[model samples]
Target: MTISFSDLPIRDEFRGMTPYGAPQAPLPVALNVNENTHPIPDDVATDIVDSVSLAVRDLNRYPDREFSLLREAFAGYLGHGLSAENVWAANGSNEVLQHILQAFAGPDRTVMGFGPTYSMYPLLTQATGAQWFAGERGPDFSLTAASAVAQVEEVNPNVILLCAPNNPTGTPLPLDVIAAVYDATDGIVVVDEAYFEFAPHDAPSALTLLDGRPRLVVSRTMSKAFAFAGARVGYLAADPAFIDALRLVRLPYHLSSLTQVAALAALRHADTMLATVDNIVEQRDRISATLTALGYRPYESWTNFVLFGGVADPQATFLALYERGILIRDVGIPGHMRVSAGTEEETTAFLDALASLEF
Candidate 1:
């Protein structure tokens, strides 16, 4: 007899909730998830393999509990006067977030974020036994300093999650709004910058605000611009005391030795690994321009994806693309869909397929 999940001993909060994921399929041209479609440089991959191979000989011992060397490398890459003391990393940005929530938010505590942002924020909050409070964004999915501060003052959450260049909508969050929100809340403030490398070179990061602010954290990932999504590496920078809080909750030696070495190897070739960012940005712009020309409204994105509106039927359009072996995302936004900036040819296939469809 098959047992029902509802009859099991799962937590009440998880009873009816679905796990978070995009539709995964083996399509010819897939831009559903915002992944860097570019392959790692052959030389870099070889070096990573060599590094991992060396690490393989030490399988008997547990990895460094602090992951000091990797932290130092991340510090060097991020610069901005950040040192190893300010850096903390986990398997992925999601885990980094989970750690933050676990440390500062739990049972009866509230975590808040603006709507139409990264969907994972709410899910992560719930999983950590914290209440999820969704604040609103503008009609165009934009947020300003005054608006953000007002929401934070009202909710008074224990933790605030700000997704810079937000997911699902691609709206860029200005530093002024972040500073205002930080000033408004005594809660721990997290700025998730998973797509920071895709933003303009001159764009100021939340890292610039970290010096005097102990409650502020700036999280980043090597998954996108580094073409290391499969490696599952993400990191953050904050006051050393804040990093200490994460350590209190993290499992001992959470990072594997192999993961540490592979990440170190990738960091050594950071410049070479990031060469595809410009090309991806170009494709993203191309998608936006062509979508606008075709009468769809595309938002200004500072990430490697575009969220376009004017789809009369999002599901129908999604299925139509699926039939053509070109998969994109329908991010539960009415009359809108999101697509990643794939390689040039893949982007062409998506555009050509989209153009052929009627409302």
Candidate 2:
């Protein structure tokens, strides 16, 4: 009488597919997922609580379908001559990405991304019923303009996803590569800059190329630099027409009143909330330098985490750190693992635990 999930009349696409899971464990020093380990400053938390409390009083009313104020705040924070008309937001960057795919890629369309990039790109594409076309990167996980353009020409996909400072490898995508790829295809081009705030201040953003590029989108999240992972606010900037397209597919009043107000409160304290970036960058560098000294090849990262290779046995090293109440990620890359840059003490704990592992 027992029926497995496979026995259900589910869509063929989902039969063997697994959910996106980053291992969740209750370890004392957790650096597994790339979360900002710093707690929200007390003052900021108080203001957020105040905002949420006020919003709760109007619970009978549906939240703003447009989320106009929040969008304006985001545009201001981004400060690239952007306005509310050019920005869109969702519960998280993942949802923002989902909306893009739903609007621009589905069924007969193809969505492409370079391999060993963000693990979510293909998953999102598949969920949208779009064919996922995985392109290639250089051996060092780098993507050049020529290589990217060539791949775009081959696929001619309906959508191209570029993860700047790609996950799992932490290799940054240059602006020229993005520009070349965009020119090579007539499809929607998305640049996920979830980690851009952690990059050097002088590094140019994909936003700089947004002018006259109606098909281009630049996405960001509060999860890393803003220490607002729990708040789950993510947004993007693109042509106003592109933002309008997402509206066609999104649920009405998708962002709740609580979510909107909390995000607005966080945006109000942008400078204070982002002050942790410098410290996190320092810790990230510390992780990379120590990994190199430990004979591991730590890739140059513009993100909050470090992806290091040279472990003789990744699982063994992962477990050893876990046993010591320190958690990191084994991102399914052979001889490699990733760890977030945590607060100073937390970083020290992870580094000490990793160093003690004989492998």
Candidate 3:
């Protein structure tokens, strides 16, 4: 006899909970998710193809479980006195985070993060049987060192998630706030820097704080800056001991040989891969400026997406844009929606569609 999912004894906590994801329909101007909307340059594509072909003949063997060479290449790119010993990687930043939670927090332990941040934090914590405490962010969806330290003191969680250029809001937290939180908590502190490359060149990374902070982990992704989302390579820089801890929880040979090849190939052409960043940043600023001029409130963004408020009806606006084949994200924020910085043409199309709307 066939049994439905609920019919079987699934975990009680996940009984009625749905999975997390953004809309992924094949729209003409798809920008719902915060993906780098640029295609790989022709030169980069050729190099990636050549590298993958070299790895195809070795499919019979398992990829290096530790991904040692990849780690070294990643370390070289980071350039903060980091070596392979200080770096670790996984399928994506999410998986890297999961491995972290699995190793450092589980069962009776607790994890905490500020609200209106990355939605995946709680879900990932739940998967590890750890309790989640979502602390509140400030009115503007920003958090201060005082507020963050206060929450860390109160909750004393085993893990804490801090997003830089935070998701949905696109605001970067001050480095002082991160330092303060680290000082206030003995728990593992994860600084998610998925959008770091989008931030201003002068913006500092949490990596600078890793000198004496063994519990602090700074996570980054190639998906955003490198435009290698399809390759799914995300990584972290932390103390060597912390990197070793993650090894205990991650599955063996998790990163495939082909993935390593593609990522390394892309890394060789880092300049080419990141050439469109300035262009994307320009579009992001333009979108923010235009939205503000139109009587909407666009929050200051250091990331590739802009989060704007003052929509008469977010759902209505979302639907209207969808009907026009211009997909953006509602992000569950009232009176607000987010649009990724697409190519010039795509951005122009979205702006034109918004310009014609009554609201």
Candidate 4:
């Protein structure tokens, strides 16, 4: 029998969603998605194809459900105490989050976090039929550790979704605060560091917290610092048992052989990716300096993107830049626009785009 949504009543909130679509651009300098404007090297691409081609014979068969090879490469490159036993691979960080919600979050349960986070945490929870609890951040877009900890201790959510160098804002929570919240909450804490590479060294190490806390899970993605947006290799590091739960729900052969090969290749040359990261940091400083000079009050960003206030209306600024062939996200924080830190050329282009704008 075929099912039709027209005949059934689903959740009312689903209908309230604004359809989450954005306009597509041509030649798409594509700064909107926080992707690295740089592509992988020709040599790395060649290696990926070569390795995947060799693994092609097993394409008809299912892949290693554990993705040990990728995990080994991941742990090796990241240089943390991560082992294959403690890692969970997925289609993307998004999938890892979905698995977390499926395993920990449920209808009567809740996933709590601060506002202006990774945007998808609440969406993921709602999609999984769980309640989303959001605590407002201070005016600086910086979340106070004490407030965040209080919310967790009080709400006692099933999953604590956190983003250090939180998306859209790029400010990190204090380390002691993260530890305090962990000590306070018995539930799983999922610290998403999609922008971890750019964060300061003294920032709380989510990996370190995994030891004492059985439920601490940190989600990472190659799509960010590794410059592999198309690769879609994101993972979580946590207690081996928690990782095993992900395997049960994850589809067999979830990641393509080619994608795994590409991730491995990128990881092999982690230094190259890091060089680009250093460049992004430089670009961030340059752009931030320029914005400050323009009287744009910017939050202290530790990620590859910057957010600013003091403009008349950020929507107008975004539209003006959009007309100039640059696409940035209007974070809806009045006078605040988020621009991804790009290469020097792209950074200058963005500055020019902004200079040409009337807003």
Pick out the ten consecutive residues of candidate 3 with the lowest summed lDDT. Answer: 4-13
Best by lDDT: 1
- Rank by lDDT (best first): 1, 2, 3, 4
**Model 3 misplaced stretches (Cα beyond 4 Å):** 1-4
Q: What is the lDDT of candidate 4?
A: 0.80
- Residues 130-161, candidate 4, lDDT per residue (tens digit)? 99999778888777668887777788888888
Runs of candidate 4 with Cα error greater than 4 angstroms are 1-9, 21-23, 201-204
Could you tell me which 10 consecutive residues in candidate 2 have the lowest summed lDDT?
Answer: 350-359
- Go through the candidates in order and give each one's C-alpha lDDT: 0.95, 0.93, 0.92, 0.80
Q: What lDDT does model 1 reach?
A: 0.95
TM-score of 3: 0.98
- lDDT measured at residue 234 in model 2 versus the true structure, 0 to 100: 91
Candidate 4, residue 134: lDDT: 91
Question: Residue pairs in steric clash, candidate 4?
Answer: none
Residue 215 CA displacement from its true place in model 3, Å: 0.3
How many Å off is the CA of 227 in candidate 2? Answer: 1.0
